[model samples]
Target: MRMMDRRTKIWILVLVVFCALCAGAFLILRGIGGDGTVAVISVDGEELDRIDLSRVKESYDIEIDTGYGRNVVHVEPGAISVTEADCPDKICVAMGRLQGSGIPIICMPHHLIIAIEGDGIDG
Candidate 1:
């Protein structure tokens, strides 16, 4: 009976440790980025397009028509920036270059979002 009780206690401890590790991993990954395909770009919560890694351009510019105004998206080598926005405060442009896969560039006034995502196996 004593041996059985010790084994059970050990198992419980092991299970608790495993759960903690899993939780830690979850939080860490969430902070850095998502595990799978996140979002590349979305407008008004409606995804307009995705950035194709294979077809990634060294430099490109995007113009968004927010109905209320216009937002220009610019991406250069190693960095991306927003040049112009019709918003009262140019917070999105001030965000500077964005390279994280989880976090996205959000223009609340325009309801536009841009993010980095992993290429699907099929992609």
Candidate 2:
């Protein structure tokens, strides 16, 4: 077996420390923007509704009919999604459920934006 030189061992230790710090930062940032419990629904830059998913006990649907188009929002327990839409691409409906506080569900044709907002994690 060959022993690593002093410089090589120091470099390896520095690399390990750097990786640990990076992982810590990532975890902290992820926790800061954890899975949100509040969902905000908007259309054409107008704030329409805000639902707290944590308090939801039953599943329901909200129909949004704007001048641009129409969309059906489904809310259940701790999740929200666009189940139906009249847009040309139908991308919003295909976005599935809102997961955490990351990318929001957007419908460009209808000018709709559904986003989850909060710093607290969903239990």
Candidate 3:
């Protein structure tokens, strides 16, 4: 077996430290965008509404009618969803409520996207 020289050991240490820092940064940034507190609604890539889910007290529905089609968004404390939509596929309604920073609810037929975003984060 061959022993590593002092310079080789130092280089290896530097590489380990660099990798550790990169991993730490990646974890911190991932958590920063997790468990979002707001919901953003958009159509055709244009923002239509931003709702603070944390402050919501009562559940309600929003009617969105655009050139593409129509959607009914249900909003409640800490969550939002598309309860009804006129799109042919109805995939947005099937997506269910927005939870955390997972996949967003999208209505491709209507060009609508409902996404959850963390504080100060835009979707």
For all candidates in order, the CA lDDT equals 0.68, 0.85, 0.86
Q: After superposition, how far is residue 20 of candidate 2 from its true place, in Å?
A: 19
Give the distance in Å from residue 13's predicted Cα in candidate 1 to where it truly belongs.
30
TM-score of 2: 0.69
Backbone clash count, each prediction separately: 0, 0, 0
Better TM-score candidate (1, 3):
3
Better of 1 and 2 by lDDT: 2
Write candidate 2's Cα lDDT for 2-109 as tens digits. Answer: 998999999999999999999998778666766777898888768899999999999999999877999999999989999999888999998899866666799999
RMSD (CA, Å), each prediction: 8.8, 6.9, 7.2
Stretches of candidate 3 above 4 Å error?
1-32, 119-122
TM-score of each: 0.59, 0.69, 0.70
TM-score-sorted candidate list, best first = 3, 2, 1
Candidate 3 lDDT trough over 10 residues, lowest sum? 114-123
| Candidate 3: tens digits of C-alpha lDDT, residues 84-121 | 98889998888888867766788998889888887645
Model 1: per-residue Cα lDDT over 1-123, one tens digit each: 445688889999999999999999877755655333333567766666665533455888988786766888886644556789989888888877675444467788777777766443221
Best by TM-score: 3
RMSD of candidate 2 to true structure, Å:
6.9
Residue pairs with colliding backbones in model 1 are none
